[model samples]
Target: MCRTTLTLGLTGLALLHAGPAATWLPVVRRRLPGLAGAGDADHVALTFDDGPDPRSTPRFLAELDRLGCRATFFVVGETLARHPDLGRRTVAEGHEVAVHGWRHRNALLTRPGRVTGEIARAADLVAAVTGAEPVWYRPPYGVLSAETLTAARRRGLRPVLWTTWGRDWTRSADPDSVLATLAPGLRGGATVLLHDCDHTSAPGAWRSALGALPGLVARCRELGLRVGPLAEHGVS
Candidate 1:
């Protein structure tokens, strides 16, 4: 019995010295923001940002309609104010509208007062158009800071980051590449980041990424993944 205890103690020490198996903890958390209804099944959430663009948004909405899916739109304060009709349509279509900052400024670099103004102004705009304050905020470029988190929390908005990004902001990111990048995390409970306004890309180049949506949805379904609103997963 003494020998057995010694061996067992040595084994415990060895395990401690070996450190954690990196693979055991996935590089990315399976779900972020800890939404309410997340489950093991393959489920995905779609979101669009930097939008309320008159031309692109309508097209994007039509595409979602074709797939019989709803998405969340992270609207810029300035843009939403410029195109209130587009914002209204997003709500009318049963999509959730969230704030994406006022000027699309990088929240990480912004001052606390500026951050507060940015988020609050955007929330006000979203609430005016949608009849409710936004519950989610996605910092421009997925950049987050202590100030950003604090400001967001104060406004009752949860900071949501994407689990996978398609790099749709790049003009050269064709539909195939976007689909490929997201293929791995397409399983479920994924928050995918795509852009409706790609100023960096060729003029109107986001069309290609938009073109890929239907097929992407089909592929996810084939893999037994269900696509739905983030709120359905208790994200809001």
Candidate 2:
């Protein structure tokens, strides 16, 4: 290939890998609400990622029960495979189970074929373990490549990113900080992202999210927003 042609090809390839990640931007979320998991104006979608952990996921399940709320748990396939019972329990408890990829690796860094296989594997494990067909896919780190989108489509999983996140993965995070970080985006139609386990986070970081759950649900109810899983969020 000529120098100019090769340059153009490289640029196009780069865009293909990173372009869709623009959805993570606020302007993109405003423009493509469905992609951002924005749903009914009177409801907020609650989602958790990197879970099915026996060490901490059970606690989240208990807390959700106490709050009388249902949230979506996006499980890593490898992790869920080890704790299939936990996956089943999440669904049995009235929560939704979705795919968070086979592992917590970013698609941007994975080869297309590997990303494709991992997504499919994760989706299959979710269905097999929970007996519920997963409906959504959230790439690790909220980064999406062209391959990630294609894999999700092929598996019939709608790609969703959060409208707001608790930043609770940090060791420094606390209930107050998680709530405050999410305060601005705590609105009707927002998809709230949190972690039920700390597999890919600081040890015990999940506690921050756990601590914030009651207050988070309360604040949403205070604003007249129904808090529930994405399945009930009415996302397009």
Candidate 3:
């Protein structure tokens, strides 16, 4: 293979396995604030990503209300735009919204200007439709490039990633499987990642998340910890 091809292939592998952006990239990591109270042992941040999806998001919201637990919804710019009313309802229901990039494109492979510009633009779109600019940002697929991090800072948003996740984005994920994966990571100040929409994931994967929500919330309470949005964690 040509040197250029070899370099590109290796870079893709690195970006995929380079740990979480908020921790992996030093330049960006410096500006990124780790979720506060992540070590508090009595608080956990329940964050749902890639949402404001009309079909699945409303279901997640309904479940959260039923369980009396609150969560942060990291919404996509395109999805929110397509379903502005859904975005409005997500905020109106007392959930915090954050940017998840425009159309869920992978920042690592995207151009720097595009990455940075979209961050600002998505922030604007979210703010205009949701009645507030998101104070936090999570990259699409949770993958961030150096420029994406810079863009996050330029937009005045904090970058965050989870301590653990449900793996609920997979088609094989079921309620029990989701709970099993997440329960081990349950603790105060832990950030739990789960997808509210599966647009970028396995089809119907959102069902596993929705099915897992009640038990997850109950488990948190039973452990004497409270589940809340990232804003509640004071990371924003």
User: Which has the greatest lDDT?
Assistant: 2
All candidates: CA RMSD (Å): 10.8, 5.3, 5.6
lDDT of 2 by residue, 88-169 (tens): 9999999999999998876666765898999999999999999999999998766666677778989999988888888898
Query: What's the lDDT of the predicted structure labeled candidate 2?
Result: 0.85
Residue 4, model 3: lDDT of 30
- Candidate 3: where is the Cα deviation over 4 Å? 1-39
Ranking by lDDT: 2, 3, 1
The alpha-carbon deviation from the true structure for residue 20 of candidate 3, after best TM-score superposition, in angstroms, is: 8.0
Clashes of each: 2, 0, 4
Ranking by TM-score: 2, 3, 1
**Which of the numbered candidates is closest to the native, going by highest TM-score?**
2
Candidate 1: worst 10 consecutive residues by lDDT?
16-25
Judged by whole-model lDDT over C-alpha atoms, candidate 3 comes out at 0.76
Q: Which regions of candidate 1 fall more than 4 Å away from where they truly are?
A: 1-40, 200-202
Q: What's each prediction's TM-score? A: 0.81, 0.90, 0.86
Give the TM-score comparing model 2 with the true structure, all chains together.
0.90
Residue-level error in angstroms, candidate 1, position 37: 12
